[model samples]
Target: MTVLDALPSVEHAAVLDESSKREIRRAILTAIAVPGYQVPFGSREMPVARGWGSGGLQLTLAIVGPDDVVKVYDQGEDGGVNAANLRRLIRRSEGVETTTDPRQATVIQTRHRVPEDELRADQTLVLQVPVPEPLRGVERDMNELRRMHAEGDYSKMWVSLYEDLVRNGVITETTGYPCLVGGRYVIATTPIPRWDVPPLHQAAFLSLFSAGREKRIYAIPPYTDVEPLTFEDVPFEVEKVSARCRCGLVVPDGDLQSYQVEIPQQDGSSVWACSDTDWCTRQRVEAGLLDPSAITETEVDL
Candidate 1:
């Protein structure tokens, strides 16, 4: 029996038809050919809710093959409800191997956070985007925004950013900042935190951003320039956290600082632990930090 036939009815609903898959694949090929150009596609309705990462899910289904190892993350946590649910859906429908480790995966479909580990050349990052249009904030009309992108008219966006820097001494836009890709079209990346922005600049892996709600898909080809919109005098800055958790995870370039925990009645004390579940688990295994006997059955599912 085929992979889809093996899944139960509820899980099978996640699978898109062959025609839809073909169309998505064609769009992806076109996106890769014209890097950074936002290619419109007929986004298929997913089993999941529209705003809840259906775009990333669709991309995952389209690119995933029987031999590929998939990884899904929601805000850097792979074991979270959203991530786990998507993982199960893909596994059930495609019956492909899945992984929590970024290095092991061929395709990683993520929401709002890239992994701390740098992805390999063979990996693909599928980012779920809420609004694909970078000019949505400046120009309300979609047609006008398309025209602005087509004509390379981004003076208004640059002016607003200049005004913001003058007023606040920094760019006010925090997440999903506009970026010029391959020195041509400006595209809005997924609403990832500023900390993840630098990784997009000539990244090793191919990056794909899909917006199911907006019905748009774009790509940043491997080794392509992805410069965040900024002035030369005042460069873009990523947020740096120095708080050292008791878990012994060290930031190579970050300074060591105390991490405090809130308690009911006792005084707060410094401790260190990883906020990223997958990274923490990987580290624990590598460092022999975790007890193998304590590993539960659920933990072995991945």
Candidate 2:
């Protein structure tokens, strides 16, 4: 028998040791203390790669409790490969309830996109960040980036936006948009689409960001001001989905719901549906259009 198989079976409820969990908890406390400021921590090795939701896994595992109902998703699909695997990890933790419904989840971890449903104050949204620094594009040196944040000088980023507007005729930036948080720090809301950026502003739920590759954790507390960087005349706009969802729901451009082309059909006409599968299912079920048993967890790649 293999060495692992030969050993007596053992059950461990928590993933990280108490010492490590405590350290992560301390860092999260500080991240909340200074909203939008990235706080570095000792990132531990995980079964998954660093950039692909490892950071988020750490954050979820660190704070998850016996009573917490956890939800994990990639681009809002609960059954996405990344989400399923991460959920598996947490579900393995004894007494930690897991659910697909955002309304029931106490802690929801996400990558790339936010849920279509409005989040409540009781929930904690943990966002996985591939790159934690907002100034990384403009400044290469870490010291300079730190100094820029400390001095509240973000002229370089402003110039970058100006250049983007001048050259592209419009701000082509969509995902990973930079936003000003608490009117003090410019934070990188990486991987989250422009459509998802608005919910971070004056949000009822606490938002936490973790980047394992960069070993940084940041936070945006409830009801904080989060403004997207934009010119005075050119107001920020989210992406437009021309087609109505397959469920016959058509929200406005900046609505909380996000749309994605449903599995491409042979007819070439793209079919759109809510990216947040659980939310869509719940909506239809509530409307009496879909049966509760008809709900299926769909697998998607972010």
Candidate 3:
């Protein structure tokens, strides 16, 4: 059956709160006008905790409609505890349809990892960024940081990287790679894997980033320039897994495959997939893609 057919009916009174919608609409409009600029907004308290995917949840509530199909992922896979919690929150609040198929989704909210495939121009990818500043660590004072960004001063960042090279031989930074957007604005590309970074540069889709605790919103419109910060000798590199997904599945254009693994403990093991739980469950039920019950607590190692 189609995604819409699988979803439950929406209750107009319960779907949206007036204040939240207004705030999001304003933020989105400001994002469109400012392009690479990061705009601050009044983020609301979500049922989910602050560090979780609350930012994405707020955006989903703001943009999702009765007809839109929503898909959420964390760390490339589906059906994890956190992903499932976020899905339950959205489903309870809005009663909208959810899926794992990137091509089938009108909106996608992700954390830490982007899908293994490429997204289209029409779809919107909302990223949950823990930090939004590329120069935050370099300049602790917000006032000074703002001035540096305003004046396009990034010498300190270069100096810092040089220091890292001298001390550690390599940058040593693993997550939250920073990038220069539109050639003028420096922004954090979030904590997504480095493999997902290049696909974001000059992509067809509009990429929106929101940090709830930070109360910041930023965007990279379709075809906008996004370049990673790097020296001429040291080029930017994406992180790659030495092994392919053990599932032996190839992701389609704008889609990804799910894998089940067991995390070992002192006594027993916990078997679960990396994809969002809601996505995996739906896929299993609808397409016979994965068997949830087959995942035992003694077979996988994280």
Best by TM-score: 2
lDDT of 1 by residue, 54-120 (tens): 8888888988888999999987778889898888788877777888889899999998777778898
Candidate 2 clashing pairs, residues 3+ apart or interchain:
none
The segments of candidate 2 whose C-alpha lies over 4 angstroms from its true place after superposition are 1-13, 251-257, 261-263, 266-269, 296-302
Runs off by more than 4 Å, candidate 3: 1-10, 13-16, 248-302
TM-score of structure candidate 1: 0.87
Q: Looking at model 3, report the run of 10 residues with the lowest lDDT sum.
A: 245-254
TM-score of each: 0.87, 0.91, 0.79
Worst 10 residues of 1 by lDDT: 256-265
lDDT tens readout by residue for model 2, 87-203: 867767434778898999999999987787889999999999999999898999999999999999999999999999999988988788999999999999998988899989999
Instruction: Count clashing residue pairs per candidate.
Output: 5, 0, 15
* Model 1 / residue 225 / CA error / Å: 0.7
Task: Quote the positional error of residue 129 for candidate 3 in Å.
Answer: 1.5
